[model samples]
Target: MSKRLLARVAALTTGAALAAGAVVAVASPALAAPLGTVNLSQTSGLVTDSPMFASAVTSAPCPTGFGEESALRIGPAETGPFTNLTPSLGGGGYDKAPVTANPNRSFQLALGSAPANGRWWVVVECFSLLEGRHPDRFVTEIVVAGNQWRVPVVEATTTSLAVSPASPVEAGTPVTLTATVAPSGAAGTVEFLRGTNSLGTAAVSGGTATLTTSTIPAGSWSLTARFTPADPGSFGASTSAAASLVVNGPAGGVSKVETITADVDPGAFTLDVAQPPAVELLGGQVGGTATGALKQATITDLRGTNAGWDVTGQLTDFTGAGNIPAGNLTWTPSAAKASGSGAVSAGTPANLGDTRTLCSSAAGSSAGTFTCDAGLSLSIPDSVPPGAYTATLTLTLV
Candidate 1:
């Protein structure tokens, strides 16, 4: 071995050792820093009537010497530049340190006030293991999550009305009008109106509002209830269906008669004759005679001299068996009398088809009482079925 050979061999061995070290370093994997990710509790499609809440969670524990940083922001749908909210993370401010017991940091955001009705988005950003006064470097590693929230407006309430002494009430009589609002929890006032004329206003209590009035005139009137919401912005107003009211004039002299009235009594009959049993035929003919006693109509006339009165009667056909023929029934007024200085005229025999005058008085008359008596004869055909029969008799006086 020579000196030149020894030097060359030493240099070559050193170079080979350096090359092997470089290859080993290139095969080794690089080191990665701790990363953070945010997961929102509500991703989207959240509807709220009042306040809402959301939570953000991190993927891993915060880095050493750095606390968790979080913020909440909200904006209209499809819009940018969201507005940040002051959130209470882990029951404290954003700058507060996270609890060590829970490795995955969790923060809660409360939306105390709801925005206007429509679509909106809630965005949350959480930075884990952040440090320094100016933490721009940590911001790039921040985790963000967003969700769509909806705050719908309250629906309008419904209203209903009821009027006492429904119809044909005497004028000057006290009448009560009640208005009820649906959704019992509704708070508002109701205005009573009579065909666009304000009657009065009443506050709703226990879902009902009432108003009393005695000044309604004598005529047909339509009453309505209009509701006014206390918070127009929150709840809408509504109106109720109209209620009909009919008022009558006071009882007094119209022209000459101070007062005139009449009373009518219905006629009844029971066909139970042993000798001739009544049998209804299919042709609408009666086998035996079925006679009904006469009905009475009494009239009280209070008038001066030269006063006259007339009475007319209208009869309805038997309703059984699809309306029994009207001509089958006939009416006759047998007895008629007048208590005053007027003669009472008897009524002619007439069928139930047309109007018939049953009684009349002379032109000259005074305060007196009049009485009328009538009888009914029924002729049922064979065609009429066997069933109960009914008819109505109407009496009018003038």
Candidate 2:
């Protein structure tokens, strides 16, 4: 070591095992590491305020057989009346006033109790392998009143929240949220949330609270439940873990139906007819044939009787130079513009000799209107001389 480094100060060397079972230590060092602060977990089995934590680590060498012990003095300073916190060594080593080292050298210590009300000092002394105690090693002070910690705080009851009906609920479906308080019998209210929006609140009962809702819209939601105790001092407020909620929309292509109805009133069933063009008598001298069309006839059945109907036509002989028989006119009947559930058929070509069928509606079908038309072929017989002819055709519907 140089003289410049000599004026310096603290020197530390790593401890190494010596051949004689003893360990070599640093020459000297400045600065001491603090001991652990008072640590408190849940209430403990031991009745004292100690043993849970070790002092902040110290640089002092803790070789084999080295240990630390604690004691309390009744005064505001180091000179106060003292009491041994750890028992003394036994047998031939009884000559020592106080001992800290255990055979295993575990320096763990505890303050069993604050027996009296007064300012107290917690003194920890390190021990050498020779049963020697160094009181100057570690020291801390405390002011005790009634053997109780000053400004004591009470632990509050905790609560947990949960949701029901699982996730992936359909929109407009009911979802239930529940909150349960720990240790039971806690009085509080629970508020439900989806993201930052509030769903509603429910009053707590029997250590639990619930909320059910059915109006949530369709979407993904980060849902959670929160609890607020009615007596804040007795119960702690807590939020539940986020619950995943996926609300689905209505299924695709859904359809709704409505019924339609109509009423039918009793009405008259009637027929209508349009006049046909007159037939021109061509080749009058030889009594040639005349072509004409029968009038269009329509039948309307406003009465929903579902009964069928048909129309027939008959023609009288002409009373001109010589009368033509009704059989001279052959007709071809056709049904047109017919509307109904029933079927309509055209009558076959036949002479209007005696009320030949023109057209007919299917049986048990009708309830609508239909029109019947026909082409008339009047064949003038060669035996009859035709100067001028006139005839009457009668149509009847039944």
Candidate 3:
């Protein structure tokens, strides 16, 4: 070979050999990259200063084949004593001592009992004894605690009173009123009132109360009740609407005509005018009757457009549950007659009941609660008990 060619060849060979050596050195170190770090985390509801929790340590890694002298460094300062460190789960392989560090390795710590209130902390650390290695840093620290929860609730109730027929009459008609209180289980008392007068009172037993009144005049009246609280502030109070009473007049055509005296209190009125007695109905249901003298009675028609009169009534059973009603008896007198005279119209229902009274304002006016007077006969529904049943009619004039 020539000298020049031999020099070039030698240079080329040295350069290739150097490149190959450098490649091999880099590859060897890359194969075993040093671990970046070891991390630890924990969670629990248990209080501190107690035995460690078994399930508190969620993730922990321990180096494999660790020597007896090797130790783990956990926490910020790594100053806590490393005693009682163990796997708490029963029959767990990581329970006993001789714990070794392994990738994806975990240990269930045996936490002491929980404190009254607070939490527990568990930290996992790792140390290395490898030659020329730096001091072991914290691998990881896990914090865990228990959960606290509760359920909230709200309660409510209402009180109400249902009066039969709503409208009332006089002449001692029987009237029934019911008071209902809600919330199922509550203790309280209920009071009954007629206008501003106290009628009676009852104690609530199982959230219900009932009352009746008799001897109520033939004028409009109101019934009201209030419930007393059982626990002062524990529960709320309740009230019921007023029950109405109506008083009816004597039969028509027996003229001992009486005048509706003024002073009939002024709120509402419910009155019943008796059917004209001994009158004939030439071709109607009340035809064929005429043996007695025609009678006349005077009533203060407070409901008349003039002289300040507006009255209303309802035809219903004592229970107050039945078909809707439609009937009203009104009168308009010439001039401002305090007491007017009117002939009783015949054909009223035998068992007729009614009520009338004066009201201070138009809002309290009631009418249309009258029955057809056909005869002197009285009747009751077939469902009515065989025994004699009495009802109260009420009225309020103010």
Which candidate has the highest lDDT of all? Answer: 2
Once fitted onto the true fold, the runs of candidate 1 whose alpha carbons sit more than 4 angstroms away are 1-152, 253-398
Instruction: Kindly list the per-residue Cα lDDT of model 2 for residues 1-398, writing each as its tens digit.
Output: 10000000011100000011111122222212222122222222221444322222222322122243332222333564444443433333211233232211111223334345544444444443332443233444444455342312324665566666887888889988787766576677888888999999988788787888998888888877787777564457778878888888788835456999988688768777653323222222233434434556777876777778877766676555567787866665677646656566777556767778888886687677788766555555778652445666766788
**What's the true lDDT of residue 295 in model 2?**
52
Off by over 4 Å in 2: 1-263, 275-285
Across residues 1-398, which tens digit of lDDT does each residue of candidate 1 receive? Answer: 10000000111010000000001111111111213334444433423411233444445433332245555445554443444544423432333332212112122233334445444444443343311211211111111233334233466899999999778799999999999998777788999999999999999898899999999888889999999988664467989999999988878825333677888643221111121212121112233223343435666565444466677766566664445555655555643444655566656556657777777777764246667654444555656444445555556777
TM-score of each: 0.31, 0.34, 0.25
- Looking at candidate 1, the ten consecutive residues that score lowest on lDDT are 14-23
lDDT of 2 at 16: 8
Q: Model 3: per-residue lDDT, tens digit, 1-398?
A: 10000000121010000000001000110111112233222232223322323322223232221121333322222344333343322222331243343212222232233212222223333322321121222233333324321111223557788776456353556776678887757677778777877767777778888778764555556667787767543467777665555556444623354677666444323333333321211110111111111111123443543233332222222222221111111111111123233221221111224442222222333222222211111122334222212222222233
Q: After superposition, how far is residue 211 of candidate 2 from its true place, in Å?
A: 38
Give the TM-score (vs. native) of candidate 2. Answer: 0.34
For each candidate in the order shown, give its overall lDDT on alpha carbons: 0.51, 0.53, 0.33
lDDT measured at residue 40 in model 2 versus the true structure, 0 to 100: 20
Root-mean-square deviation of Cα positions for candidate 2 versus the true structure, in angstroms: 53.6
